[model samples]
Target: MQKNHHFSYVIGAILILAPMLAQAETKDINQTKFSKQYAGWAATIEQTESEDMLATYPASVILWAGSTFSHQYNSPRGHKFAVADASHSLRTGVAIPPGGNGKSASCWTCKTPDAPRLIKEMGEEGFSGSNFVDLGPEIKSVIYCSDCHVDGTAKLALPRPHAQNAMAKIGLPFDEQNISMQGAQTCGQCHVTYYFQPENNNKVNMPWIFGNTADAIEKYYDTRRFYEWIHPISKTPMLKARHPDFEQWSRSKHADMNVTCITCHMPTVTDKNGNDYTDHKVSGALIHFDQVCAGCHKSKAQLTATLERNKAEVDAKSRQVQNLLVKAHYEAKAAWDGGATWPMMNEGIMGIRHAQWRWDFATASHGMYAHNPKEGLALLNKAIEQVSAARDVFKQVSSQVGAAKPVYPDISTKAKAQAAIGYDEPAAVKAKQAFIKEEIDKHWHPVATTGY
Candidate 1:
């Protein structure tokens, strides 16, 4: 009887809140568009495996580029954890209200379903300038059906403005794009590389004007003199490649063969009731080879062996490229400390910058080796070659200056690497906790709305 009464009370509370939740401007209270497959995946909060994922910046990253990655980085778990993880992540930082944490609102773009709604309510300018804390009250929903669904029709749409702009810049106007491309484009909306333009209140932007190729994107940044950061060790202008899955995949054989990201990651599945729907729980296709790949490759053993071989080869090349980068940074630092001027070293550092970009592009892409082995290997090889060229320049400058080789910093663990880069991880974590306890808890959840 008590349980029944509690249930009734909760239902009544929901009824009272329904009007507010279903306001004319934001009317998805029924959540009819939420995919069951996505819900199931979201519930699996322990699905934490990810390729090339690191809980913190690697030593190579610290010794070579001088990035602490905002003191935290972690493998993604599940859709359900996205908002919470982003909130607590040191990468996001403890954004104080009004001023925020120097990060843009675009950081929240992929983490919440409320983003699309917020974008609609606040114009692009308003959305771009909105503080993270300011958004806490409004954006309560995680990634959901409404984010990708077209109103009145359940068809998928790319609601992300930056992606649409990128597509348009590439002569592929999104609205006029074919229905067949919708799935990939929808995923690309968030999955592709983007940076917030500081000039425009850190508005979300992508460097797709020149093209999506590694070199082409590099060229675009070079032309604009845009850089994500400057390497503290190499003093080279640097651009960090975010997960560039769409850019790499678009150039892959699978894309040429008309394979969409959804085709693989969200393979169609049928239940015992004979209804067919695409699985919305997005992850790598390799995990569910039978569901996604068996139709193409009959022998699972052969397929697995082939994938493993490709992955091994790529992993080896990636490690080699990383080692070369570490060596190049150390050499450049030695030359610099020994009085190598910018006029003598800038060209070589630029080469290192471009090379590292390629290496990062290949390393960051999901299963690039297995997905597109040829391109993946080529990228790594190019990085190795570039590093070699940079090393030659470093040697020339060091020889001229008679500088001794710099000792590599000891950074065997994430903590040591962070310390090398001068990151206070504990302090950042504590600030996040304090923000959650005081600001977020006080403003985000109302006492009356707790039951609802």
Candidate 2:
């Protein structure tokens, strides 16, 4: 009797909320636009992605130029583009490592649904250290339902070992008992910032020992002295923040209300057959605010306006900090070129590195402002403050070395900026194109040409 009453109460509550949800624009929830097949490299640039993706920055800063990211970077299209993007990206060049080498298989971990199977065949460490080319032919599926769902059932599964290890570190165990966290963890599996553990076969590990906050992660990196690469111009050890969507959203207002990532991203919808199911399109919540927020929010238009206003504020601050950090890098280079001693350049180098790290942490997640406006703006302010201090150090150093003020160069365009940082853009594109013709074209069918 109690169970029946509880179920009735839930249904009645949904009925009451339906009128409130109807205030927003409606959608045909049955549609699925993205293909099940692999979307090759051309689709990422020519069709689905915006040109602005490649031009997110004014130019290639020294930190990016020193890393593989400068070779090719974009806003991710969707699950369909996973395997093809991983395989054909200029960053993951055709460098096949020898036996016992790492970083090869680590790249594919989050890009394919075949990961669990491959990891089962080879241990987590073995898979992480294996040659990427050796597993090429075996790559069959892109990210799909099996990644989070049970093989024959719709039940969710937390099969990713790396994700499990990360949660354990933060004292959140992934098991059958914690179904609510499991829903979010499925997305957290890839969305959180992580690094290749150098000593453990380059195994992917999240720096969650301290915690998930930006300060905690940065402290963990500082204590461990884990740097992604060294900037060529500033010679500062730099950190590259991978998409930290999970980290940004984990402690958000929505999360505080027990709203999981699935609640917003994969909203419930009915099929043509009148059967209801969770939509797997997996897009930003703002796109379908009616379906996601419903009774919890006002009209979609008002909510969207608020979100956009917040984003604009965050974007402005980000641009300000980015320009300052870029100047710091170039000014440090000027100090080096002018024969400044290591002691003189030390403060500026460390400042730029730390500042950039914070900036990237806040900006890397495409929807950071929407996810957590307070945290996003806080991080950008820190970046602005840090970069200003760094600029002071550079100014003092330049004077000590009898050098002129650093003149910002002609990096108005992407090509020009990358060139300024000494990255051969033409050569990278040419090589990537050749690789597609020879390797990718032969195996994968390019279905992403349409509706991309």
The TM-score leader among the candidates is 1
lDDT of 1 by residue, 96-170 (tens): 655335566777888776777788888776888877656766668666665676754557777878888998887
| lDDT of each residue in 1-452, candidate 2, tens digit only | 99999999999999998987884335212112222111221223333553445476655444486887876777776666777767766777753535444246888888776778888999888888876655665677666666786654557777788898888888877774366678888888988898888788888889999998889999999998888888887888988888888888887998898788888877676666886666666767876677778678878888888888998999898888877877888898888888898888888888887889888899888688788889989998998889899989988888888887787777676777787878897887787677566766665445311232
Model 1, C-alpha of 430: deviation from truth (Å): 2.5
List the global CA lDDT of all models. 0.74, 0.76
User: What range of 10 consecutive residues in model 1 has the weakest lDDT sum?
Assistant: 443-452
Backbone clashes per model, in order?
A: 0, 1
Candidate 1 positional error at 371, Å: 2.7
Q: What is the C-alpha RMSD of each candidate to the true structure, in Å?
A: 5.1, 13.4
Q: Residue 320 of candidate 1: its Cα lDDT?
A: 82
What value does the lDDT take at residue 276 in candidate 2? 65
